[model samples]
Target chain A: MSTRLLTKYATPDESGQAILKNAMEKLDLSARAYDRILKVSRTIADLEECENIEAHHVAEAVQYRSLDRSGWAG
Target chain B: MLVKTFGAAVTGIDAITITIEVNVTRGIRFFLVGLPDNAVKESQQRIESVFKETGHKWPGKRIVVNMAPADTRKEGSAYDLPIAVGVLAADEQITSSRISDFMMMGELSLDGSIHPIKGALPIALQAKADGFKGFIVPKANAREAAVVKGLNVYGVESFREVVDFLTGRKEIEPVEVDTDAEFLKEQARSEFDFADVKGQDSVKRALEIAAAGGHNVIMIGPPGSGKSMLAKRLPTILPPLTLDEALETTKIHSVAGKLNGHISLLTRRPFRSPHHSVSDVALVGGGSYPQPGEISLAHNGVLFLDELPEFKRSVLEVMRQPLEDRTISISRARFTIDYPASFMMVASMNPCPCGYYNHPEKACVCSPGVVQKYLSRISGPLLDRIDIHIEVVPVPFDKLAAQKPAETSNTVRERVIKARAVQSERFKK
Candidate 1:
């Protein structure tokens, strides 16, 4: 029997956690944005052929929240 | 003598075959029967006029034309050519030996020229399914019907040409379309691109995400912030349509009579921006004879709503269900039909009534709570359905006059395609 290809990818590690914490504190991102960030980071990792979600991927994903800033509306 | 030929009736983008039978008996009056609407009943006048104009014999005997099954309603003058041909064959003015092999539909002018009919694609599809050898349609609808393979589509310009072909006196080659090559050629060209927009890089990034994830987006900004300009370019970033999607979209457009002469497959995705004053029935697809609406017409493409709050609340409310289901179902006492309404919604609106509620450099003129009131015009449910809410700021004079061009749509589309590929692969698991 042929083995099925695994669909799941590797999760974020410690460096990824630091990036997320930095974005949440600095950007004041919502819980929804937090989840979206992780998903986008995973995609970025997939694009780069990386086994784990890297810190740079998380940083790039967080940068997408340009509209989420509080100062622009005020 | 009695003769039988065929036509079709379109309902909700599908077609049902209609058989037209004509018999010549020993009398002087014409009798037309079988559930024909005013347009179909009036075909007798057109047919007689066409016969007189073309120098064809109008049978002196009693001529009766019947369209079966009598239970279904036959609308439009598409039956003009079919009934005329059946009468001619029955009167022995034209050969009848090979009449049953083809299904014919077209509107006949007084001078006997054939006019285009709607729903040619669906009718051709039904004819092919019903084992008809060929479909004879107006020359204008030839390319539309040619999209269907395994069916001989003969397009004629006038009654004389049709008679010449049916009598074996002349030959008419069936229209053929290389659907794939045509689709690829058309896909290479796009009318709008992101490179034209001077700035709003943040909004472009948000739209890229929305396109990649199939999420709906809303852009709120002051006037002249380029919200509408940005929304129009979203289709170029989304993935090109597959063949099945092109056919499905073409069928809806064909049934709507939106495909004009010599139009082949619609390779580019549609961008429909109906005015804000559109009614509830027009936006979501409903009527006595239910035709597809803007949302359904925008199938597999983008539906941009500029000045979203300017739309009547009830009209926006009607769109909520289709937005969720990706298909709008119209229920009548006789039948229920669903039109595909799957599309990317990109709505834009000014920040407030004064149009400068949150402008970076302009002071708000509206009252304290007026901005909230304006925002509340778009219902909570509709806002909830939209995943991304972007704020667009106008580009500065320096940015607008900058020497470097902004990123082109092709570059953004490449990343969107890659992201979509990743998502589909993930979903497969």
Candidate 2:
């Protein structure tokens, strides 16, 4: 998806935003990883019948980015 | 006198209708024109033999057959039926007015028998769209072409039968199919089930998410971790194929000449696993003729690449664009064709060269940078396209020996279908 569509559909609420910001800093996620995480979180929330993405959904989506994490094999 | 008939040329997954125009002139030769390839050009010899065997005399006067939209290269022996039919009608041998009302496609055998041709489904679809009253295909291709409703599909066994049916001398039944009923009946039969596997619930969970969101995934595991087994069963847990998807998948398989003679439509999702030692042409599809490759064959299904690092670097390099656009376009000197390749990619790799990197019990024998070197075979750009990465370890002996019954793939599939329903609703504009 384009960056505009990603921001429009997958952007989470305030507290979810805080969780994403913290995860971005701690995990050193790239912008690509960030967009993917948002999309996955949106799916996770949809799975749970949640209209908005929750913090738990974002956390679960972050776990899926294992390959993007540097030094993962070590 | 001039007579017209119709045939179809399958280009990529769709078919283009070719109008065969035949006229008799004063000379004593036959001419086949309109950029026909060698296979199509060779149909004349078979036609001559078929006419003799069927007790019909070959036309001696000069005859010219022109396939309209001549820029499109007609590249198969399937044109034999149409050309032969048009000639007979033009020469006043078969005085049937029904010649112009249908599309005829088949390879004529020397014994006057009609041979099955590839891409019958796409050709029939094109004929129906163009308002043809009927489609005449070889008996072996009848069921495949009959899946398209609102068109009479006649399956003829030999050239004599075609002549008799067209001349109103013999009655031929048009094939009929209840595509919806057949599709529903076949939806419940899956070859593999998640319940058959002993353990690896975590990996199954990851695959479940991948199915629901249509995400690509990779698994890193040691040997004997059941990666291939899990990959094979992924299609079982995904939602059942809708009728439209079944048709789409069937068209790709039909153009690739992969469908069996009797199977009208594909009931189950396809799972294609090409070995790592495949060429770029075989993997992503490009050759002198530009046939659909493994990716196109794997359309609307899972393409499992086992031992991902073992594949040639150039092969993986060629797949990046198709992975992004979900369609592979091949540009030749004369024409460019696009094949749909929207498959969910499932790839597996060992953790390192020795298959023991970060293993709980195994000691790594490979020295320092060797592990990194082995991992570098799969380029980073390809990895970026994959959204889910999950690690798997061999099931412990206790887990393997446990008597507990695992959850069936059907049960997981129910939830996946529900999730997909939500996704479609959310995305519906």
Candidate 3:
């Protein structure tokens, strides 16, 4: 569920890429995992009951992958 | 038909009561109101699954969950258990009249276990403040919420457990916390004593002054010097948090999801050591929905930055305000969140890039100009905020090999506690 949230909103420029990478390695996830991020974005859209995914929702979904965007100490 | 339950909404470190109103009607959809975030809004699916898994029929009718008063924002999954239970009771799936006096909270897993949630301290405190009779949180968070007085705190591991307790089929005992006892245990002895550190009496003296005045300090030294180790021991000497201070500290940590849940109140001062590569936003904290950062977590405690110059310039710059103001104000478009960050800053950096700039035993590899450039990475203004500056030199071979029993952490802590006591007494007046 959390993965889908990451794909739709999180950008590779932010930490989301690293978080996605780590989850992929640790949990045997695939490109299909991108669907999880999309799902997360979808859920975020649903939260607002908006007809489409907003820029802010996509931005937030990406931000949760903190380590990817900024090379933070894990 | 609709039913209402009470939960707590945490802002910064403070928690206020939020009314969760569930309405089931003859309609086609699920609606969650009251400005819920993604986590809160998606809770319907999780809660619905839990209901089905627990042998209760899912509400086929249109369900609307309105978190009131209409304008306030609600975040996190902590509201899941309460909302789920409220729906069940209201839908007549679980026949219970006893849920009225007891507040419940937890994140529902598909398989029926109740997952842990954050800010138990603030939520429990809010429950007590609102005159709620009791609270039921996840088992892991029971100890934390139990710290609040005048509230019966119960911990449940599964949706069935909560249902059983609420429906009077089974009874769940309330968890108890002894704040006084926890304080006494914290006061007992420290593991790292000042006596163990050798040949840096000057640094120790500087630390003592910092402790007395609650001032920030910086230690410049070569590699293998005890700067990092000394910073770790600072909390041992720091005065224990006052009851009010402890609660305040706990709230920030709770909101940040840093509290492990064993300890409710933070009697001991926090010592946060974020690595050098931290971001400006992560260091000071910022997002669409702002959360507490390393500085906020270090409230009323110490923030130790080792390899200080290695941190990004922008990241360190963000700390300048909080360093001076003793608090950080995160301005989001919707709301501004302020977190207390009145902590003693203890930073350590090598005199030069190679870390052998001032070593007597080893030759300095970096040229003279290089040393200045490396030091220049830390801005003059940031350095100015630090009240004490000292150099830590390597221990002499004789001192390192000496058989003398160094003074223990207990000895240093006594003096620190005494100095802190003096300061507290002064602040009281």
lDDT of all the models against the reference? 0.86, 0.89, 0.75
DockQ of each: 0.16, 0.57, 0.01
TM-score of model number 3? 0.81
- DockQ ranking from best to worst? 2, 1, 3
For each predicted model, how many residue pairs clash, with residues at least 3 apart or on different chains?
1, 0, 18
Candidate 3 local lDDT, residue B352: 88
TM-score of 1: 0.87
Classified by CAPRI criteria, candidate 1 counts as incorrect
lDDT of 2 by residue, B166-205 (tens): 9999989999988988899988997799998888988988
Highest TM-score: give the candidate number: 2
Candidate 3 falls in which docking quality class? Answer: incorrect
DockQ of 3: 0.01
Q: Which candidate has the top score in DockQ? A: 2
Stretches > 4 Å off in candidate 2: A22-28
Taking the tens digit of each residue's C-alpha lDDT, what string does model 3 give over B1-429? 677887878777777888888878887688888899899988888987887788987777888888888787988888888899878866777777777687778888989998888788888888888788899899999888888877999999999998898888898778988888887787555666677777676677657656655667778889888999888888876766788888888888888888786777777888899988788888887787788999989998999999999999989888988887788998877778888888889999888888887688888888777877887788766765664567788889898888787666666656666655543453465
lDDT of 3 at A67: 19
Every model: Cα RMSD to truth: 4.6, 1.6, 18.6
After superposing candidate 3 on the true structure, give the runs of residues whose Cα lies further than 4 Å from its correct spot. A1-74, B427-429
For the record, the alpha-carbon RMSD of candidate 2 to the native fold, in angstroms, is: 1.6
